[model samples]
Structure formats: C-alpha cells, structure tokens
Target: MTNLKLTRFAPTPSGFLHLGNVYSFIVTYHLSKKHQAKILLRIDDLDRERVKNRYIEDIFDTLNFLELPYDLGPKNLKDFKSSFSQSERMGQYAKALEILRQSKLLFACDCSRKKVEKMHPKGYYTGFCRNRKLPFDQNETSWRLKADMHQDISFKDLNEGHIVGKLPGILTDFIVRKKDGLPAYQLTSVVDDLYFGVDLVVRGKDLFGSTLAQVFLSEHLGPNAFAQNTFYHHYLLQDPNNQKLSKSAGATSIQFMRKSGKKKEDIYMMIGEWLGVKERIKSLEEFGRYV
Candidate 1:
C-alpha cells in the first residue's frame, strides 16, 4: 500500500483564466483524488501589478463550477495553520532573498527594457547590468540569481516521464527580485512550496523550462529545506497551428468561451475532452474516474 500525498494547482493572476488553465486544474484535481491525496489551490499572485480581484473570484468560481472540493486555502482550512495566500506572506520572500544574498549568488541588475534594446539587439539579458556595480537603481533595477554554467536538473514528471533542462543557458541568472522591491516568481514560488512542504506540483507542461531554476533553488535552500517533490506536466491544449495557449490569446480563455455562448457543460466537456477525459464527468469524482 502507498501513502497519500498532497498535490496543488497553482495559478498566477497575471491574466484571465483559460481552457488550458482550467484543463490543467481539472487534470490535477482528479489526479489527487485518484491517489486519495489532498489538493491545495495556490494563488500565485506574487505579481501584484496584474492581479485582478475579479479574476481571483473567478478562480474560486471556476473551481466551484467544476465542483472540485479543495482542502486548504482561503476558500477552506481545516486547522491547517497556514491559512494561505502568497501575497500575505511577503516575509518568506525576504528570507529567501537574504539566503541567496548571503551566498553571494545574488546580483543586482540595472538593465531596463530600454537598456536591453540599446545594448544587445538580440535581447537575452546581455549582462550589461550583470557586471555593473552601480547601486541598484531602485527605480529601474531587477535582481538575478547567479546561474551555474553547468548545473542541470531533472525530475520525474508523473504524466510526462523524465524531464531535463540546464540552469544557465535558457535564461541566464534570471530575475529573483523585481525593481519594485518585491520578489519575482521564480524565487518566491520555490520558497513558498518549500516552506509549505509542498511535495507534488502538478502544473502545465509549459513550466518544464523552470526545472533548472526551481530545482537549483530548492537544492540550495540551506540543506534539506524541501523534501523530494514530484511534478506532473500534463499535455497542454494548443491551437490548430499547435501554438500553446497564451493569456494574451483570447481563444484560450474560459471567460471568453463563456461569453461566446458556450454552455458550462459544453465548456467542461470540451475541457474534459482536451484532458483526455473519456466520459462526461458531472463532478470531480466522475472526473477522477477518467484519470
């Protein structure tokens, strides 16, 4: 017999919810049930600029629409002291930032969008600010974790099998702290997962590139900071041309689909089909049956 584990569907509020997002939620939602596991709705709203209150409510509504009952979050908490909200836990990010800074692995960057354009036409963060010792331009600065030139990380993704990537090449020493004095996604996300003891992160196939950055962050979080967390990067629903859905694209949005006169059943059915759900599932349990 196997022990039950916890899985979570983390969504950022940078944009409106989409079919790809909803399908991923459904897949992860059912998967946790299949294993008799717990599911957490982690609102990755660290990006304060774009988070909208309506979208936040929409997330709760979508979960209810699917009728998937969750265990922990602002929506529900059963004495799980961590009544959750990433935005409320700003201190965690600060501590993680301090750890990285102490290791001398933190670098302040001053390259603005304008600077990147003027310096390197190709635009992959040409390290103009990488070497700059200029005091962080508080108004126009960002921070990057020093990427190991040879560090490679891999994880056994439940749905996709073994996935691999290198830490340095994809996006060199990427931003951990934004110029606005707030932590960026890569740093706080890993920190929150580690601090919350999240061991199963079931998310979109798109974040596979994050393998390097996150694994590296986890590995360096002061030793044994996090347990072995498994990931499931499920197949994403793409367009006819196979371009993965982006928030910027309207076709991916459930709200858009809803506005297009898509019945909620029709929307769920389309999402279910996209996720390879074989039969019509009226509830989360029925959804779990297909998985």
Candidate 2:
C-alpha cells in the first residue's frame, strides 16, 4: 500500500470562488507538494440553499485557470452529478449517525438558534436540552453530540504547534443532524475525511474551532478515527474591517477578476505579495520556487 499523505481541497460550492478561496487553495496545494502528497478536490455541496450549478462550474474554472492538479474528483459536470456530489453520500452519513446514536453520544435538540442565543447571552450553549431526552423526530428537532463541556480538547497543528481550548467555550453544542433532515458540517466533514483517508487538512485559521469539533468527534468515534489525520490552519484573508472574507459577503471573486481582465500571473502576484514573497510569480506552478 502507498504511504503518501492524502490531502484535500474541500470547497463548499455555495457561491463564486473568491480571493480567500484562492489563498487557502494555494496554501493547501503548496503544503501537499511540500509533503509529496496526493490531492483530492472534494466539493462540499451540503447546503442546498446556497449550492449552485454556476458555483460548481466556477470551481473547475478557477482551478483550471490556476493550473492546479488533483489526483481525484469528477472530470466533468456529468460525473459530478452522478458520483462526486455530497448528497449522494447520505447513506454513509446516516450510518455514521447511527453509530453515534447507538453509542448514546447523541441527544435531540429542539431549541432554535434565536432561542439559544437568547438563553446564553455570551452565545455558549449550556446543554439546556441535552438531558430533556427529547424524541428524535427529523421534523421537530436536531441532534447534538454529548460534548464534555468541562474538558479541554487539544491537538497538534502542523503550523500552529500544540493548541488547547475548551469545546464549550469555543463552540456551542454543535449540531450533528439538522432538524430539516440534513447532516451537519461537523458530522459530514469528519465522516468524509475518515472515509477518504485524508491525512492533512489545510484551511484558514478561522476554522480552528471547527478543527477542535472534528477532533472531538474523531476521538469519540473510535480508536481508528483520526489515526491518519493532521491539520494545518493557515492565515486567513480578511477584508478592510478585519473580518474574514466570505463568498456570501460578495468578496472579490475569481470570476470577477477574470471579467476585470486580470491575468493568471496577476493572481499569483497578489498571493505572493500577501505571503510576503519578494519575487513575483507568473503561474501557480511557479509559486513553489519562491517558497
């Protein structure tokens, strides 16, 4: 069996790909190359409301424009519809959810976001409904994992070194299954990473809390979970307000840049400048030379 580290650029195709997306992709791509790893381009199209066909096509367009190569993914839209879509993997998610349920690690939650925010002024859920033993009805309530709020979860990040934080302090009682019968990001991502054997996950530091949640899930899942995985949370690209750039915020996107007549080298140069690399780059492939 091959021992090559498996890394993935999992993008949620909810909107057009933006500069932040490019930056994170560059970081992930560079790290994968540095470690001699295989890359998988996984599309996270879980949120049906925001996921768009145009966004999916735009992902391929942007990656092609940057000349990024991956070892796995759909070759075309047809393949994507038939195989790579996350909605097609519901059975896998259901099985994982069943495992969690059987372990008695999950509890039904009926509180709405507004209600939770109102109950906890600071926004940290105090497990108000965890012990209510609410019935699990897809139409009525979401499911939350039984988090050890008092315990701290720590992990070794490749870039940040050792980091520690309390799960309750950093994140609220996270949803494993939405009341609308959808799998939560935390559950799907953990399941997907485990299934795909992804060893290195590179993304923005904003997701550090998310990493903690996933690590928490991995530990609870079993000994085999997280055995092959590690993470690298890189610097985030923020806007003028210092807020992280988001697709929903109408951040400058690759499609907009291309429409503005920006060349591929220009995009590389922007990344180089942000990363403080002295020499400019003409292509995404040349970015490694400067590093």
lDDT by candidate, in order shown: 0.70, 0.81
Backbone collision count in every prediction? 0, 0
Instruction: Please give, for residues 15-120, the per-residue lDDT of candidate 2 as tens digits.
Output: 8998889888877787888888889889998888888899999999999887877888886677888998998889989988888898999999888878887887
Across residues 1-291, which tens digit of lDDT does each residue of candidate 1 receive? 233467777887667788778778778777776667787778876567797766777677666665656777667322222556675678878888888878877778877777666665555566665566656545667878877546657776665567676754546678888888888888887887776667777766667667557877766668753435777777787765667887889777877776788766777777666656577754445555555
lDDT of 1 at 279: 77
Candidate with the greatest lDDT versus the true structure: 2
TM-score, candidate 2, is 0.91
Query: What is the Cα root-mean-square deviation between model 1 and the actual structure?
Result: 3.6
